[model samples]
Target: MATRPLTGTKVFLILVAFFGVVIGVNVTMMKLAIATLPGTDVDSPYAAGLAYDREISAAQDQASRKWQVNAHIERRADGNAVLQVEARDASGQPLTGLKFAGRLERPTDKRADLAVGLAEAGIGIYRGNAASVAPGQWDLVIEGDAKGERVFLSRNRVILN
Candidate 1:
């Protein structure tokens, strides 16, 4: 059998092919990563930082109020979730005339968050429903507003089967 020597052209082609595959794979991976990435938690980090003091004061006020808030969530068979909230004062009297809202937030994906508008079902009792709630881990955020001011805020982690 006759043997041919390794030529400069062959070496150049081999090097180009090797680096081409590596670069191609890297570009594909980068595109996939950017496409799948969920954006920042807050739209403006600077603004959020500026509001840190207000959040702290609000939390202190909520604590001082010593309000009693209870939340119940039930996932129905039809992929909908029912949320019920009951608010009471420290003395156990029902709290009235307050607007309540709830959110089911996906910890990993902000786009999957579901907002629920709660209406007064009875004294101190509020009820809301969210459609097509996927069964998984979630952050349940409940907020209460009085006279257009945020008076209560709570976030609890929950899992649904």
Candidate 2:
């Protein structure tokens, strides 16, 4: 048999040493790159990006807790938009005799008050006609004062169409 130049054990050791050197060199290069970068909010730019991401997440969480009244837009067959207001107490119980101020805002930047013909048929529903409103996305803001406190409900972004 021909003499083997390198034993299997020797080949395995050489491969392990080569990989170890490669890994060490790669780690050193990464450290050097990090050291050369500017020292701002964090040593690495990725850490700064993570900090911004956390701030955005916190803001979103805060926004979700906002106590805004919930309502829906109803469109009429005559192409006019109708604004419906629902009055509720702090405990979410429907309240009657709630004097509300409803405003319907159209896409043309025109606004009209829908509080004139408001009728309360049930415990907490107030209905009014907004004939000036068109069949598109609209903004409905309703305000009311009951008991001893003033309540403000703004459905800032609503779709009428």
Candidate 3:
């Protein structure tokens, strides 16, 4: 059987089909990536940058208070998560009688975010519990206040293992 090959039409058709498939795949991937974006932390980057000085001043204000805050997580066997928080002063004295609260924020998905609070456990120590938190990375944003004003703020990343 003799075969005739290298026809112009065949070559053109094959090249067109190859490029078409490549374009289709690229479009699909691009759409998926855009659809699954984690999210934006700020609404306006330019505005946020412009306000950077204010943020710095606020942080400096907090630092001036000389309050030290430490926080961590403990994952239990029953799939529950516990958040432990402790606060003190520069002189190592416990900062008691302050309000403390936090949130379990999913790194990528807001749907899985959880609000957790740390009630007073001991002198300067606070604890809170979440019934069931998915095992993964979680950002813990904690705030402490005294006399209805913010005193300390901290953001820590922890893994639920």
Each model's Cα RMSD? 1.2, 16.6, 2.5
Query: Model 3 over residues 1-161: C-alpha lDDT tens digits?
Result: 99898899999999999999999999999999999886787789999999999878878999897877888788899988898898989899998899998898887888688988789999999999987888889998898888998777788788888
The TM-score, computed over Cα atoms with residue i paired to residue i, of candidate 1 is 0.95
For 50-155, candidate 2 gives per-residue lDDT tens digits of 7898657755653564533456567777866555667665567777766666676543434233432556766788776767555566667666655654444454
Instruction: Please identify which of the two predictions, 1 or 3, would achieve the higher lDDT against the true structure.
Output: 1
C-alpha lDDT score of every prediction, in listed order = 0.97, 0.64, 0.88
Each candidate structure's TM-score, on Cα atoms with residue i matched to residue i, is 0.95, 0.46, 0.80
Error of 1 at 124 (Å): 0.8
- Reference-based TM-score, model 2: 0.46
Off by over 4 Å in 3: 90-93, 106-112
What digit string (tens of lDDT, one per residue) describes model 1 on residues 1-161?
A: 99999999999999999999999999999999999999999999999999999999999999999999999999998999999999999999999999999999999999899999999999999999999999999999999999999999999999976
Give per-residue lDDT, candidate 1, residue 53: 100
